[model samples]
Target: QRDRFQTLAEYYRIKHGSIGPLRSWMDRHWTVSRDKIETSELHRLIVALNFPVIYTTNYDRNLEVAFEIHGVEYVKVANARDVSKARRDVPYIVKFHGDFDDDSSLVLTETDYLDRLSFDSPLDVRFRSDALGSTVLFIGYSLSDLNIRLLLHRLWQTWSRSGYEADRPPSFIFMAHRDPVEEAVLARWGITVVTGDDDDPEKGLLGFLSRLAALVEANPSDPPTLESGGELP
Candidate 1:
């Protein structure tokens, strides 16, 4: 049973007897890195190039710590309230699977998933709009997470139903692997999969992004603005 392909949330539940208590315990103890996690270089790159990032991660605040360490302005969107206050100029760090500060806020259960299906909440609309509008670059995630995959597929389905046209911005995945079968499936639903090379995908992506940043900055027009009002509907 332990060797089976069980989700992290399910595995935790089986081992600990309850997801809430387990996640709550982990919120207090779960550490993503032991080697003093930092993102000073990445922060400098974004600040120097004036690039806005909307990083969606399931983990804790290691990324936020990195940004704060370098004094780069950022906002964390937990719910509609937080989204409403987020500044337009700052980068957004959306914790789709919840964060450490709030235990009940964690979206780790089957029920939590069902709640998101409605997409009625302002936070849900805000996230879906950004996800559908921007070229989302997924990092540190395997395509195997069914919950997340379903959420993305639903977004695509919603867009199609809403009459979003071809000229709309396409969503992209920045994965390390380039499995043809998986890429085909993602492509079928409008998500472009961009794979980094075998040796160093991160470096490859960084180089490409560096070039992209230069090009975007070189343009005389105003920077591309992510909707800051945060109002859904």
Candidate 2:
């Protein structure tokens, strides 16, 4: 299993023998079934805090469903046209990886990643700009994810060579367990490492997010407009 394809594209190519099959598989698994997600405290907190923008790699529509359930207006941007026409009045949920509704837009293979990287696609540009302008808080990610590490490295490189490094905004990652070595490396990349207790890590993370939500609620800033950016706790 460890030697299996490193990307979904390759996995589907070998297993199902074609992209069509792969797309079908993704549609079957990732499509949102319910009109609304069973809102957890964390989801409710996110809706209550109301960040200006929420970027997700997930193909599922859980975030959008949550917004709908709460009667919060939001724009879901998954392609170039969406980005081009995005408005600032409501929160924007950017689905960078791809959305289940669009098979052509999915980025599931190494080829897809390379294509996006080569062209510096609109989504890529949007994420880079947003990352540079605001404080990014990474959640539900693991240190073992090479893609995220590479992205962080690129961001750090950009900041380091920008000459305004002293004024660069800090990024953060929430981890379930404390790994001193990983923490040190992330610190070198200008990322602050926030960790929860290993014992009952999920509960700890929930508490942490709840506290963050409370902070945002108590100090609600104006929603970030199209011309401006906002920070996530």
How well does each candidate superpose onto the true structure, as a TM-score?
Answer: 0.71, 0.84
Q: How do the residues 50-142 of candidate 1 rate in per-residue lDDT, one tens digit apiece?
A: 435554545477667767667777888777677788888887777775777765566665556667667666666787777666666555566
- For the record, the alpha-carbon RMSD of candidate 1 to the native fold, in angstroms, is 6.9
Worst 10 residues of 2 by lDDT: 223-232
Query: Please, what are the lDDT tens digits per residue for candidate 2 over residues 1-233?
Result: 21144375667767776567666776787666444354466676778777788888887788888888889999999999999999989999998888877876777777766676543778878988998999888888767766678888888988999988878876788887777898889988988887664468778678777767666667667422111111234
lDDT of 2: 0.75
Each prediction's total of clashing residue pairs, residues at least 3 apart in sequence or on different chains, is 0, 0
Query: Which candidate achieves the best TM-score against the true structure?
Result: 2
* lDDT of model 1, residue 179: 78
Compute the lDDT for candidate 1: 0.63
Which residue pairs clash within candidate 2?
Answer: none
Backbone clash pairs for candidate 1 read none
